[model samples]
Target chain A: MRGEAPRGAPNRLDLHDLSLFAGWDPGGRWRLFGEFELGEALVVREGRLRTDQREFDYERLYAEYDLRPDLKLRLGKFLTPVGRWNLIHADPLVWTTRRPLTTELPFAAHASGLSLLGEGAWHGGVFDYQLFVDDSLALDPDRGDRPLAGGAGMGLHDSFDHALGGRLHLLSADARDGLGASLAWFRRRGEAADRLLLGGDWHRRRGRLVLDSEAFYRFGRSADDWGGFLQAVARIHGGLHLVGRYEYIRSADLGAEGGAGLLGLTWRFHRAGVVKLGFQESAGPRVQPDGWILSYGLLY
Target chain B: MARGAYRSQVGLWSWPILAVLLMGISGGALAAAPGIAVVVHDPALAAGLDRASLARIYRRWQRIDTAGRPLVPVNLPADAPLRRAFTQALFRQSPEDMRGFWDERYFQGVSPPTVLASPEAVERFVRRTPGALGYLPDCRTPPDLVVALRLRWPRAAGIDPFGLCQEGD
Candidate 1:
């Protein structure tokens, strides 16, 4: 018999952050699991004080079953497994901080609903395909005053109304040696829209050289927008990594392209933990002063 | 004058004596190489694997067999010197680090490779199951079993050369 845990019990917690996670998996042919998260953080936006914000969130609660070797069924609230960076949790990430603007602008981390996942490998290539139906709720505190809308904006209320989307991933043969290319697509319901993302990464172990580049084309009913980002990281021995990234976003509604460049270094004391220091400067159309960022992450 | 002559003669004699003693020790150690075997149930598989491939299989990177069955890899006790040698040759990471890697994987719903306690246990399990692969000391190899890869510990050279398969003694 498979082991089981109680529903809604605290399975993990971090005192420094005052965060708690509770989850349970019931033993059955169809496995069921659920998780909850509660935490607090301080934010300063537009030089205004947004301090000590309390957040009560349902991280994930889902049931999954394997119908076949290549097909699986999932239902309930879960993280949208779209981008490579989004599928894995932040704590286990290679970088101390996440790719800002891009990941945040679309949606919050998880959606509640049903999904179908298919994964397989053949001829030295790997593929992951997913189809999902979700009722999403955005969690951005700053957007509280904005009126909700059914499509494209956070105005959609607790109406059983749903969204439909999917993603497809095709990886090249040389992924193990750290050189590969991938293409991904996502489309949400209620808006006549879609997004196509293409990305490639190359890495060499001898000198610790890495290059990552990605392009996104957003197609909507009114007008289309395009954006691209590139990042390079080099290990300078003694557990220090230097990184640089450039990003640009252009839309039909906007007069000119807006973008930012980041220069950073990360120190890794352990495989699952790191400390990072970086400077970000925004330019073109809407410019912001170069600011410094310090962050740390731990994974268990 | 006689004392000086004796001291010089003794110094010359000591150099040749030390060289001859060191050569004898190395030669004797080479003459008696310990017999360590790499054992598996399938003859074809035993012939197909090289050192690098075997290492990859143990590391969970190569999950499928030539015939497409999910390969099940097993190893001896954690502290066994042979196991250490095998992992050192295969993973280039310490066993403790490998354990940590697997623990994280477990949280992600992935299972690590199965571990067995002894060579005899590995041999018995491999003999009874298909898709099972393991290693054992050469002298205990069963006739029905095949020799997939062989490793020898070189006391003289201070390194263990792995995946060297040869016919008979």
Candidate 2:
């Protein structure tokens, strides 16, 4: 439900996503979860579909075993242990349909490997932690941002270059309030380039108000880039909410600086459906064409 | 002229009659609202829990207790009216909002609590399991059931439309 400038050529509706989420739990010893999406894009040249392309993507397909109530072992492809947005970016979960580039502009978002996830009580709160190591192929970062599933998202990896990462989360005892930090290191084949990233996130929800934000910085041999977003949502009434978001990015590598302020209102009038309208204004040199979105989305 | 006067009299009296009928329906609904009780297998494990702890337990966001015991929260069937009342009283969330929350959590490799066949089944499960916690529609208090908390109906119903259930209350 996002339209760009001049003619709204690359309008978001040019693509469609048919998605499914399923899970099975057997007596608490083991659990299974899968999220799949089939995307069809117009493959347009001007305003017409020159050809159509189809892709089936498995965003998450993993089996987890609870070795302990506070800890679990999971094997398969999962969202990288990075930031809040990556884990909860699905259309039905996020506050806005428009995504911030900071979340996806660098590094592939998926990791295929074994992960150790654990949580325990701490003081007046709890701290959750995850460590991941993967040597799997990733869809290029830019492609993963679009709705078009870039490749057969379900796969095995033959290339043996490994990256290790982890995230630590400390939250209030209730788990509604928290802070998180993440870091990852990856040096591609023969030390051709070294890439490292650091990120932090915070979220708090009280009564009718919710606030969450995340920041990410990538350090490279030659150029450094950083980006972040801050957002809040206030529930005004039953199933009605007002939301505001600010997104910023500075890329020395791409020599680009940009930001956008977005405000939206949503009416969750239906059980699983919402109608949302949002307006965004761009800032900086890139002149991100100001736009508005009116759309309906559902979880089911 | 007498027939016209009689029709006017019926119209004038019908408003109060309808009001009385509506009051009856509402009163019946309120009286029928199911009372809810937090039940645990062991009475000793009930301490350190309040509304916040209750919400997290049912949400499956927190799966352990204060003393680090693995807590397994059971629930009644999804469509049970009593279950709706319990969810409303605790989470202040509609059934659909909950389904969506569970779906999102599933993709995160987190599973929701188990749904037992009936509230009686939930009561029985909590009795059999060491670290089990659950809710029942009434405070009947089965032979082995321990009621950690109980809420009178109507007032305890999702009366607080916002998500935060009064924590200590």
Candidate 3:
């Protein structure tokens, strides 16, 4: 369920979505994965059901082959690894219902391409890297989806055929701490500005506390935008956590600056089930409504 | 003569009883401080492996072995005490604490270590499957299986987690 209430507006609630994930490794070296979601599966506003909101969305569909035990070749459409959150953005895996705009806004969040991915040990740490190229010929394009702040914003709707990107992450020996960097270049369908994006992310876990942050800067003839968010989660006890975040984005297209502060609690009652309740307040420009939000996500 | 014969008979009877008591005491001491042994099929593959490397292999982060072959790590049942001890000693984490990590890896098309029904099953699998790795109660570790790292967990913390122990011999 999702709830949003604009200033002086009545609060609205709706059944948010249902997602399906399938992964298959049928012996040998070939593998397949897919994730599909039924968005706005049901909606109720002013105590009445709305049927027009339901639609099917394909989030990821890809095929991978083992080039070696340490390397892989992936082909098809998959989540763009801009930072960290985009790769694991499923509601059940994240702590908050409101995604930080920095993660999604500056670039497209998903792309179709072939990628070379691998990881290895380095100086007692582990590093994984990926290099990918996406062309105009996409496997299955969701034109309705647009590039926004990793998760917030109303920015680009034009599709890009020539896109190239790479990401690298280094994790501590314990795998509890990591730092990541991402770079991408692309051209919009009708625009001449060649878009270039540079982003970085950090994650650290100390005892029961975790800290995550990501920032991005985008520059091109068509876009000049920068944004980021800092989030922290403290484990209150078993399966219960207190989450807090501050996010800000400056979109040249909107000609306005937007920022939001959120405080919430997440209860992971089961290993694959999570419930989040948060209250958010916005200052400057409004990217999203300021109100109470609740969502429940499950992975079956 | 009769007294001497009787004494000889009592002495003979007491020797076996004393031997049995001694054996019981030693066995009890061994049982009191059992450790977990990280085992592999080949001794060469056992080198350079410590608690951290074991943790990485089990986490699926280090997928390949020294020879560039995929490593197959196995685990006992989740509820097994040895499994708990192994994870705690190596990862400083509980199986419950790894749920989020596994969930993310699941989406990445990575799988958790294969779980066997028991330590005996783990031992069998490790011995039969090349590049297989597993852990067992030190006392249960077979001599033919190469012991890579010995972890004396919470129950046996008095002993060193990395030091050689007799059970793995």
Candidate 4:
């Protein structure tokens, strides 16, 4: 569960975030994966907690059939396979208490679409790719989609009339070191405007140290904006990790600018469970909220 | 008042204890290795494999072998000591680290290799299944199994394979 309030406000502790995930890949030809999330704050007024802000979200519902080890086709609503963060943005997988702001713009995290994901291996490592297409089916947030994905400027599925996106990711076959680049485009759903996004991400892990970063450039009808985050996690002892992240964003549409430097410590009880506390220092031309946040995330 | 003091002490000590336990579990303290032999069914693919070959094959990175046959890498259960040694020596990952590896791989629509219940099962499966490969403790190599590579362990004779197979042994 997670929640945030300013340093000295009528700080109220309310139920914040919870999720359930189930996946099966029984060493067979078929696989099933899904995620159910309940988020409270993002849907309501920034400071005021309301029941209307409470939302149930279906982040993913997909089934895949394997053509080979390297190739598979997926059907249903899946996380956009764009940058590294969005796909692994579930609470349990992230290192910081608050999400980096760059993940919020351009498109919703959920895309009801189809994807062709495959990989090629060489002496160096494995190179993987994903191709995806989603239609302009303006989904209602109250109807189990992203309730707060519209905070940036548009609804979760309102980006374009239709969309086409793909990613090329390469990592050590062992998954220790990697990098990726993605490109996407879609015309405005009901306007002459259009939006295209170009993104790049990279990560490397050696022994007790891990480093990762992702950046995106937006080409929109009104303004060209950009943002990214660089983060590091160092294992201090056992399951304990010390984490640091620097986030920067320039949102031309929302007029929100600037960045934050965050330092955190986490105790991972499992690969999918962690307790994290972090402090953020806001800076730059424009300012984002600054506060200390505590979060506990679990996956069962 | 006494009970409150004890409760506070428990709370203070619990996390450090858990941390120590996790470190012990993640770090394999077995006899480094237990003399594991890389075994395969196909005669043509029975050559001694290098560290990269083991990494590529077990990771399912390069699926086809030298003979142009599709390769299937089999494993004894996740708790097998040989697996711990292999991961540490070859893949340079602790068992805890491998868990993170698989979780990340699932994000890419990839699954870890198949795990059999026993080393005997792995040996039999590799023997009968074409292009199948596995490893076993050196003491029990069945005649049908072709030794692709032999890996040595420190004090190999003193460490029991079953001891390595036991969880956190």
Tell me, by DockQ, which candidate is best: 3
Please list all clashing residue pairs in model 3, or write none if there are none: A103-A150, A104-A148, A104-A149, A104-A150, A105-A148, A105-A149, A105-A150, A136-A161
Q: How would you class the docking of model 3?
A: acceptable
What lDDT score belongs to each candidate, Candidate 1 first?
0.54, 0.69, 0.77, 0.71
**Which digits, one per residue and each the tens of the lDDT, describe model 1 over residues B1-169?**
9999999999999999999999999887664444456666666666667655575466554554554445567888777655665565445444654654454443334455788987668889898877688876555567777777766642333333333222233
List where candidate 2 sits over 4 angstroms from the true fold: A1-12, A41-51, A138-161, A187-192, A284-290, B1-57, B61-72, B76-103, B109-111, B114-121, B124-133, B136-139, B145-169
List the candidates ranked by TM-score, beginning with the highest.
3, 4, 2, 1
Structural RMSD, model 4: 15.2
Model 3's C-alpha root-mean-square deviation from the true structure amounts to 8.3
Model 2 DockQ (Cα-based): 0.10
Poorest 10 consecutive residues by lDDT, candidate 2 chain B = B160-169
Please provide, for model 3 over B1-169, each residue's C-alpha lDDT reduced to its tens digit, 9 standing for 90 to 100: 9999999999999999999999999988766666788999767678867655676688776666655666789988776777777877776567766777899987666789999997778888988988889998786677888999888666522334334333244
Q: Interface RMSD (Å), each candidate? A: 8.0, 5.4, 3.4, 5.6
What's the lDDT of the predicted structure labeled candidate 1? 0.54
Clashing pairs in 2: none
Per-residue CA lDDT of model 4 for A1-300, tens digit only, reads 764554654444555776666787554556788777676644233465577667676667888766654576888778777888888776677788777767656555666668887766555566779899876364323333222342423333333456789999987755688899999886534446668899999999988899999899988767788999999999999889999999888877556678879899989977768899888887642223567777787754
Cα misplacement distance, residue A55 of candidate 2 (Å) = 1.7
Better of 1 and 4 by TM-score: 4
Q: Write model 2 residue lDDT over B65-132, tens digit each, in one string.
A: 65556678887777765677777667554554466567667557576788898766887799899889
Q: Higher lDDT: candidate 3 or 4?
A: 3
